[model samples]
Target: MQALVTVQHPAHVHFFRHAIGELEDRGHEVHVAALDKDVALSLLDAYDIDHTVLGTRSGSLVQVALSQATIEARLVQLARRLDPDVITAIGGLTAAHVGAALGIRSVVFTDTEHARLSNRLTFPFADEVWTPDCYWHDEGADHHRYPGFHELAYLHPDRFTPDPAVLERRGVDPDERFVVLRLTGWDAVHDIGDSGLDGLPGLVRQLESRGASVYVTAEGELPDALADRELTVEPSEIHHLLAYADLFVGESPTMATESAVLGTPAVYVHSQPLGYTDELADYGLLWGFHGDDRNARGAERALELLDAADTTDWDAHREQLLAAKVDTTDVVVERLLGDVGATGTARTATARADD
Candidate 1:
């Protein structure tokens, strides 16, 4: 089988990296195409995944639309050349459109229910729209629910083992209490009205007051106050450092869930309430807060968690979560390879015949 996988964000690379390798190992051909989002192309290079650049994200919403249209046109041309049996992506707006134009199958995966605009544009055109079972929206008969978070596609024990060398390389003591903080660039269409890390300097001071060292990472540039704390680790190995952190305090749900999946307690202080995040909180693996005062309240909550870190049986919570979730890469590989009840070629034939 020949497949085309599209990645728009760095997380999508992680979500599909293992599946791409698995497909190739099984004698199937896989082609990767990506947007030049933060560290996305770099991550692909680090993972040694061959990918064609679709286009770069622009500074404004209107420019983003124009960029995507250009990217979609390029994607359609690439699809014509490859004649891939299937096309798949995370948000999948472009993939769905290309598939529809060519009468091919497009499978989309999304865990974020709050991506309303992206979802509205992609769902009606996709052949299969897959989300975690925790996702609460109903996109009608095409919506398929699976028992795993996107993080599981790579972080599951079967796929990853945290390296202790990450601590040693950074000169971090294994016994030290440290926090990993992530901040995202509020540039996406969904992030228009939302805010994150309201007072970056204040949060750093508060974490310092509790005697915990903090390391910061962001999708955008760091402030002058945070310049000293910026984490400069390789994109592919940042998860190893996150796995060893005492706590994760961030604005990105993707990082919060990644921390939780790696057995680190996470605090997401953003205003978004994603279903997977809510489910992770239910499992005691994450704590989240939002609203106008989330920064102050979130800091207080982080202090509380830091104080109780010694007594919290985090491994037990992680074990329960692992027991409840399936290896998501298995689902991705099956769906893309046309083993999810209908092969891509079969679906393409049916789609053409219907016309």
Candidate 2:
């Protein structure tokens, strides 16, 4: 099979890197097209994935317009040249719009309710939509539903195991009680507002009170107050830290899930129109709350949970994650390949004017 992938975010790049590798290992011809997401491109280059460039960036209004125009031109050209058998992207709006116009099979994989906004609005025009069982969007038309999230597909023990070497290379001590805190850059599409250095000081005091070391990571601008705990390592290496951390706290939903799957107690505060956080809580691995609730008192509550946490139950949570495992990449690819074959036959018939 011949396939084309479009990635708009750094996370999508991570998804594609793993998905494309799996596709290629199964003898499929895969081509990736993406914007100039520095982190994404860095990971791609590091992994040596051959791909075409579509100059776009997920940023400011003016930058967004320019990137869209650039992507529009590049995508149009790519479709004509590649004449791809199938095109798949993770909620890739650019790809969906272009593929719909070309009458090509467009497959969108999404897990979050927020990411589905575009997909729900534009999905009727798409050839297929794939999402986890947890996704409950109202697409006007019927779409294929997959059994797993991207995290489970790639990070699932059956498919991929995160290597601790990433931590060793970053100078992280193998045996130390560390807590990972992810500070969000107050500039996302849906930021939960700022906690400033005040929140950090309190949290640090609590962690230090418990004889734990703090490590900070963030996608947004780093605050001067937390400079001492800054982790000077690659983004992917952060996972190794999470895998062994005593606790994980972040405003990032992605990091929250990563922590939960790694069997680390996670607290995702603020940051959004809540989506998977509640579902994750049901899994007995994560805790989440609104960042803006004045009376939320989640920090105090989290500290209490930490004090009463059962380390022996960590393995139980891992078992739950394993039981919920589904090879999402394989399932999504198979569905898309099936759609591509069906679309090809329909196109042939329509060309003969047999509609």
Candidate 3:
């Protein structure tokens, strides 16, 4: 089988990395096309996944449209040359477009219900759209609901084990209590009206006042006051760091879910409510807050969690979460390889014949 996997965000790389390797190990050919977003290319390089650069994101809607067109064209050309049996991506707008143009099957894995514009544009062209069972929105017949979050694709115990050496390499003492704070740039089309945590400097100061070491990871420019608190580590090593963290306070749902799945308690402060966030909170692995004063509430939750000594229960909670969810990587591999049924090639042929 020949497959093309597209990655637009750093998290997408993690979501698909193990699945791609499994496909290759099983004697299938996989090609990757990635956008130059954050640590995306770095991760593909670190994982030794060969790929071509699709494009980078733009700030404006008009520029984004142009960039999407350019990426779609390149993907189409690549698909024509590679003659892939299937194309897949996380929020795969380009793959959907290219696959439709080439009469190939495109499968999309997405979790964000708020990505209205991207979903509207990509769904019609996609052959299958898969989302976590906890996803809030419905996309009709073609949408397939799974029993797991995207982070489980890589962070599941079956696929990952946390390394304390990653902490040692970063000059962090494994015995010390530390908190990770992730700040995202609210610049995506879906994030136009959304807001993340406000007053990051104050938040860092508050965390420090509680005798916890704080590490900040920001997608946009950090406030000058909080610049010294920035976290620096290889992109591939982040999960390991997160796994050992005492707490995670962040605006990015992806990282929050990642931290929660790793057994670290996450306080997610964002304007929107995500299905996974609510579900993780239901399992006592995460806490979610919204509205204008969310930052303060999120900070308070972090402090409360930090003050608790019985955090060992987090592992038990995480075990429950793991038990309730499927290994997403296995699902992707099985679906792509047709272990359960027809492969994308068969679906593509049927679609072409219908036309």
Q: How accurate locally, in lDDT, is each candidate?
A: 0.88, 0.67, 0.87
Q: Which structure among the candidates has the greatest lDDT?
A: 1
lDDT (C-alpha) at residue 181 in model 2: 83
Models ranked on lDDT: 1, 3, 2
The alpha-carbon lDDT assigned to residue 341 of candidate 3 equals 33
lDDT of 2 by residue, 120-154 (tens): 55576677666555555545344545445576655
Candidate 1, residues 1-355: lDDT per residue as tens digits? 9999999999999999999999999999999999998889999999999999999876788898899899999999999999999999998999999999998899999888888998999999999988888887888778877778999999999999988887788777667889999998988778878876788889888888889999998887899999999877888888898899999999999999999999999999888888999999999989889888888888998988899999999999999999877788888987887674354433332342233
Lowest lDDT 10-residue stretch of candidate 3? 345-354
Candidate 3, residues 24-90, lDDT tens digits: the string is 9989999999999878899999999999998888788998889888888888888999999999999
What TM-score would you give candidate 3 relative to the actual structure?
Answer: 0.94
- Per-candidate TM-scores read 0.94, 0.86, 0.94
- Model 1 reaches what TM-score against the true structure? 0.94
